[model samples]
Target: MKTGSTYLQFLAAAALAGQVVSAETIAQINGNKYLSPYNGKNVTNVNGLVTAKGPSGIWIRSTAPDSDERSSESVYVFDRNFGKNLTVGDVIQLNGTVTEYRSSKAYVYLTEIINPKLVQKISSGSAATPRVIGKDTLSPPNKAFSALDNGDVFGVPNNVSLISVSNPTLVPRNYGMDFWESLSGELVTVKSAHALTKPNNYGDTWVVGDWKVTGLNSRGGLTTVDKDANPEAIIIGSPLDGSKNPAITRVGDTLGDITGIVSYSFGYYTILPLTALNVVKAIEPRLPPPTTLISSGDCSGLTVGSYNVENLWAGSAHLVNISDHIVNYLRSPNLIFVQEIQDNNGETNDAVVTANLTLTTLTSAISSIGGPEYEFVEIDPVDDKDGGAPGGNIRQAYLYNPDILQLRKPNFGASTEANEVLPGPELKYNPGRIDPQNPAWTASRKPLVAEFETLDGKNSFFTINVHFGSKGGSSSIEGDARPPVNGGVEDRQEQMELTANFVADILAEDKNANIIVAGDFNEFAFVEPLENFLAISNLRDMDEAANIPQLERYTYLFDMNSQELDHMYISQALKPKAQYEHVHINTWVTLAEQISDHDPSVAKLNVCKK
Candidate 1:
């Protein structure tokens, strides 16, 4: 046939030109290692089948696979102007220099070839079969990231180091990051992938294919069981075919089979799909169960709630919605610890520290919703010293139903001064700030401790509401540090130590002191600071006391993981009969419906008995 004759003539013409045809393949250039040995060297007459193309270049796969798991059989050819002309399935020969591209400040390095000296379109319509995953291909390793991410522990001080400085050899099976790096630029297919995280503004999501996964919650996403909760998961990026991905996705949405090239971006291993993804099946979100018992201030017990209102000022929005959540979801507890209550003027920076308007507005909203007329008490912070929304003098406060538990008033102290815990029946002030003048309290919200007596006038309990220093100033999770520096961790530790010392002082006076420490500690329950608090006189986290599943205990969503930032730790005396309910009124819902970043939680403690 004429086609066969033409192919023979083409081969003859190539032999006469001495062009060194069929010299190398893409696999040779991409060895099973972090850095390429052929890097900075000129590669000549590399033949490949173009599987996909983008604005920057084309991803070419080896027509003759090397069949090596350690080496990638595909590579990216950088020829922006000429790449746009190439079509999928086109067999091409490229001559270029291989280079490792570091995307940004992140330490990940992507191996790619650039500045093609020759881009010969040998033939069109070549077969480009994507390597099907979850069928016969190798599954992702079950545990740890590469040595680069340091194994089993990423955020500990002992393992922190830079990959660039070490350039450690790749151990693809040991770590998720290294596994994806080994397959970089390779065209692969992930069959039946389920979304592990909700789509962000960019329509990017983390997903796991048909493979075994650890910490698989009932909702399908991985949770914090140990540390490496998401070993089989990878992020899916925007499609290169110029189509929008699906909207209204949740954690358990079935994102069907995804065929794409492996990539690294924004400190995560990613996949660039060839086409936009369509949801195969959607699972309705499982809402949290309502609190069992509503509080009516019976002498039998006291119910307490804690929440960060997210900068609630006098004229701020979401006032009604927040109050609604409190009344309906939180069940209108007897005493509620609230944080981020702004000054009367909101974020005006006018040096006014009082939040009478803000508190009154919220209380009025609660009463309007058929809830009790709760009275609030707080010691306002100095101008903007506490870190939060600028000019919004955010501080902690207590809102209690007068009919349930009355505040035991004590001699008030100056707002700037600290209120020491006296021996019995009285704090320096009834609802007063603790250690406000301590250097540890500088630029942070001081713990608000208050003494309350049951309406029956029998027993009294002390509660310390605190919002510790946030994780600002922490290094990037993908930075060179192994256990990335948790910014403001030391400050938060000192804050917890100071609060614990105050509780210790109270216990010294009364050995069986009924005390509760509750608020946004801004650290994980397993973190060192909280561990230090647990060692203090047997204070137990309500999560453990209430027997909530470790994977199901989360009050805030940050990055890819659901974490518990807001917590309530009860004294040893209250742990036996205490029942805590995490009202998931905010975190799992859509961002637009969120009144605050944190979900409010209620705990019923037998303060009267214990």
Candidate 2:
């Protein structure tokens, strides 16, 4: 694809980096194809039959390798057409020219497809349109059937977006799939629909209700009849062919493409000769912008990032957009932590509500990130909110890189001091969680803690994150404020003190152990109890290391000014010089209105022993 000196220089540099391959050699490509140039000449215009195609390129196993070892033969393929026609058992006698890439790898710049039998032409097939009901439409199964009797829900949706069938022509259905799986979502031109709907820009007519999901060569959506949770059975795949998969799609509406037809038997929905997806058409789906975030890209750098989870409900719908937004920044950072995650509440029509936070929702959101190498960790607060927006009183949470922070110890139970303070006539949780013994023992939201074998040291430090009593005022907003009896600001202060004491106790056992207490304190820098407690003790507030003007010390922005309510305090040990730093105080300003009442407080410093 190059045409000049600039291109030649690029090729020379790539050669230096050991990526440029201007040679005649034989190496294993995609499956086992050869990479030798035509007639020993470094040829770029080599053409051939498509043995296979994939995201990695095409598969063209060298026919010249030792007959016994296929892998040894090498899978030759072209960078541009390698992954084409990729599928699980798709083999063909491809006649494409061989080429080398990166190093000694073989590839094909496929010229023609020797085997076009991959397609199962819908022989001017005319299938009956299934019946539709309610605002939602139901239809006949993709393939014919005696009767589809399942739970209350059965039949594909009548979405006008992707399932177009109108008098006017529509764009070719762009299904990201391969030639291998005939059942995978695809697009075939039907001469005319017995019945039609509206039309989209791409000559796509909305096939309301249901139409036959033909192309029986690949996967079928049916399943082995069963009464259990089965994603494999429910998968019809949105194909990103429609207005792209809705970022806020339901938990059950997953994006998938199978290679074979699915079938149900013995009361269970199942796949006949089960076929999972192996390749996706490289075509990008067309979709709209998410509700909040606008244009997105890798956040500044990949170290750490932030999100509101559409009000902290981890299960909140439409988080997919935010997910893709965050992935842009995931290449780095061995760890990630989030705030405002709420649990799933069945009482509400929408199980994933943003008003409150939950563990299940957040865990699910993070797990969807897609890289197997990435692991997850989170703290489930015993008490979410009292009941309103934050009715459960859900606290802030943290997630770390297990690869970087191996868990040494984790404490979810309250300390002995807490158990003793209760009973003795002070049943604080009265009509609700009246423990009678330890009213204060209930974990409304305890700071998440873990001992990580920090990458910089032998012994690990206790990393703790918390979202103290909500609401801003000194006492009015405090859930730990006044209980009428012997509880007031003093009791609230004691709760915080109790948590701090626990940390001190932990360090006392191993004085050399480093510790980090980070999160929204709810209390400002001027609060006597808040500042004195942390200052009176030897603990060091990370603000000192910031070295920025006091004006920049704040983390919570109100009106036009920011507040110091959010804090990150590290041990005094790494003060003078801790290697890297990117607290980048003004980063939140870029957030503008989408900003949470709370601002993100980040620090990039590795603590060490003097």
Candidate 3:
């Protein structure tokens, strides 16, 4: 009999010999978890078939795939030079170290083999066919984004933990992220793909295929209904064969079929196509008819509108288009709450802090189009104090038809002066900033409060125009962080609290005050900040009051979902007779026809009913 130490050494040597004799398959290298089990380990003689070759490297698929649905049969090899001698349908074996790669912490890692060396080309001339995503292969799950998100991807206190660290097993049939992760590096084809958004600057287009999807609007684009963000959609990135993608594609346009390699880049899972995709069916260039909620032309009814003009300057070329949208599509509401009105000099940091010229130019354009000759009121922000494009000094303003509405008390306050509600349910300053010195408004636009009345001064109501802090610094929805970070949420919450308190003071003075709070809140209605604001202020969202269908209530389109960023809220007094419509002038048109990223909205209310 041998000693115990000698016996252990013999067992270790036997195991090492077994490892040297066995070759790893692609499925074995990619385990069921988010991270590979063999990460950071050097392996020899990995066998696969060369599926596709691009400028970066080649994709290889296992000849003998396992029955595990969670394990991908293909993977990318990151070697810029090694793929030059390779071609599709060549069976090969390679030696490399398994690595998990991501450009930053905000993105999920792509399982890859780096520093690869081709050991053998086993065979060539075999057929390389891509698996059809929704037909022959498994379809992407439609409901949830990630199981790691605890049922709500937009919940607060985000970035609490990372999916990378947890490395949970994938549930490919339920979660969207898991479904895509299961096919990480596979060659797949999307059939009858329809564009979900306009192509980005890099020519990447978001699209949903013939697969079953939820929240599909009548316009052939997906909308955010309830908790679903439409995870069945995927983005089509640049072509691997180095061709230019169509730049003028619009939402609802069709790209017939796409065959590409599934990969992750720029915080989203994308398909790098084999060649450029052309628009097989182009959408019509006509815009939807103007809103039906026209002005009542008297104190019996009030027609109000809200739009974020996207940093309008006095001499911007798109002024005519924007004026046309406001006149024809929005029906030229009696009062319009507009945001992003830049200074007269337009983005010059020379201490010129007035927007009179910009507002006049827009009003003149509207009048020239046979629309209302609107009068405007605003408090110019301190030079460069507001956060937007640097030196832009964007602020919120009111554009009202003087024949229908007028300022109740024409006392405009200075930029930094805080407005207060007095005993008469009136603002101390007619058009004033709301709590400008508060930390919540730091580097953000302050709320503009103005008291309005019918031309006869018989019925009075209050309006607050707000452009809250933006959603900058937010993490990607498909990022590693669970319940991804919503940047500026805390500040938005504080800002909402202050605005609600101001509303409370008005209610405290007169419980039946007719107040209409509207503008770009910069947060979704279902999110925490807006929810808290609605809860505290007792303001009703006009969309609900108007009974707009759940699928049609959107004013902006981004990524894979058509969502609402501009909103109009009403006090309890105006909720009884509010009617609203979202004019889809921008969202339904091609990117070249869009004057602003946001679509304008119109609402008709009976402010004098009570």
Candidate 4:
């Protein structure tokens, strides 16, 4: 080991000014002034020694990369609002003062780091000066590499995953304690323990033995307040020749090694010093994509658009409702989802309901626009006795251009609230709708799902459409609100949530699977039901592309006022493939008398490989 008066001076000078350090503390720690305290004045300038962390959110940067830039500044964030604006590959530094925070571990905190840059150079007398070390260089240690990937700990092999010991018992009882005590004030390599398969919030790479040393130099004392029940670390410096365990010795000009059993489990793994690590270098664990069905459409990368076609329901016996709204979605659906289809009896979709052709009627209409290649998937028709509003007891349904997408496995299931108990004769005979938990009445108009092979015959996700209970306010306006499905706005909210939860349950089955939920929810974009849906599920609303401007946002108009009631939520699994985005909101009336109370929404989606 190299000795230090001049070496210590160089490092200390580089630390932020105002920092308080004991005369003996090393000077060259992370000294960027922009660190926490957000205070315009630099407190670290005075104190040479300030507490920091083992390193998770650590940062390093060029002190002054430009004339306008200060000698020290870094980026850090504790605020949620600002975090939302951040994007991938953004290079930033912290600025706030150091403060304790609960993360994977509870270690030291340095806030307010900013002015991100790499590779800084130093000018004479300038904080810009580089930290210097005089230790004689050595060659890297040569040992077979080992990688650890058990549920308990994982890392790249060789450098960061090595462990010193695995003994169930120790001689001094906790002899490791004595080792640590002897190695205080020494420079040691430590892996952040929190990265282990199991780690506490306090990040610390479990201790490996001290760096093996030969031709021993003096090992200093460490005065750490180790409140931890079992502390583990690797000491770098040494009073090591005397220890009962094997000692490491420098053999190469830049590397060192110790003779010990290579762990069948952990040695050969790479272990790094937290303060000296880079985040981008950290690899996040992942699950292989689903193996069942596959989606080959690059639709996520194409100009994709989505919209809700208002009120296409089965009404009065033979009059199946069909709207001009859905005419545009025929031949090009990577996947299409829509809502609001009413039915009579168990007959639904295009089946004969109340002599009214619902799915069958609309299927004809959609085929007119999309050509014969179009088809549909829907929930079993339900009997809504106590006539619900406009679309009757409309729930959800869809029309699709099958040529673009084929399903791997479409989990078509019912919603979660099926009791069909509105009030009066209008709903007296009406049956309830989807409620996943109630297997007793799965036939209710629930989400319709069908997996298909694209015309090219590749895999894809099935789309579900919904027109949740409208804002009938405190009671079902058309008929007196019944007991079960009638808690007023609360019930409507609850039902939608049930639907969302039901869908989430499916996604949870395999988070990597791609899914999309679309239709006229009848609730505002920011309403609780929609918000909760987004929260619990790994899905994001594509509405934002149009939501930025109110005019661009308004889709379904009621009484002539525009509101963002229609929606399209896509799974995060497909986020990386999303390429095109558009919303064609047809809210105006043509010479032909307008069909329904709501407008039709349309989107063209594209997914592609980079």
lDDT of each: 0.77, 0.32, 0.87, 0.33
Clashes (candidate 2): 89
Best candidate per TM-score, number?
Answer: 3
- Number of the top candidate by lDDT? 3
Where in model 1 is the C-alpha error above 4 Å?
1-23, 148-155, 285-287, 475-479
Return the clash pairs for model 3, or none.
none
Write the residue-wise lDDT of candidate 3 on 232-312 in tens digits.
Answer: 989999998899889888888989999999988878888999998889998775577789988889866789999999999
**What stretches of model 4 exceed 4 Å from their correct place?**
1-334, 344-357, 369-372, 385-395, 407-458, 474-487, 545-550, 577-586, 590-592, 606-610
Summarize candidate 1's per-residue lDDT along 1-610 as a digit string, tens digits: 0124554454335434432323377777887676776766667888888888876678988877776777788887765665777789998887766766664644567777765655688999877778876454577876666565545443445335666566666676676656777788878899899887667788888788888777676677676545564656788888988787775666777889999988767776778998888779876654556677566467456789999999998898888888988888888899999999999988887878899999999999999998889998888788888878888999999999988888766455567777787767358876778778778777889988888878777778888999999888664444445555677877888899888888888888877778889999998887777778777746788999988888878777655566788899887777776788787767555545668989899998887654
TM-score of each: 0.90, 0.39, 0.95, 0.39
Q: Which ten-residue region of model 1 has the weakest summed lDDT?
A: 14-23
lDDT by residue (tens digit), candidate 4, 327-386: 332224444565555554332434333323566665665566653344555554444522
Q: Summarize candidate 2's per-residue lDDT along 1-610 as a digit string, tens digits.
A: 1135664455445434432222221222222211122321222222222332333334332323333221222233434333443443343333232222221011112111111122221122223121121111222233221111122111111111111011111111211000101111111111111111111122221121123433211111111111111111122222221222222221112223222122111121212212222212211121212222121112121133233233455444545533443443233244445555555552343433332234444434555775213344453334433222444334344555544554543323322212111222111211111121233333334445545554444544556555554542221110111110111234335446755665566455555556666665655544444655575445776666656444445434321123455666666654454322223222222232232444343455454343
On a 0 to 1 TM-score scale, where does candidate 4 land against the true structure? Answer: 0.39
- What's the C-alpha lDDT at position 556 in model 1? 76
Cα lDDT, model 1, residue 397: 90
Off by over 4 Å in 3: 1-23
The clash count for each model shown is 8, 89, 0, 138
* Residue 395 lDDT, candidate 1, scale 0-100: 92
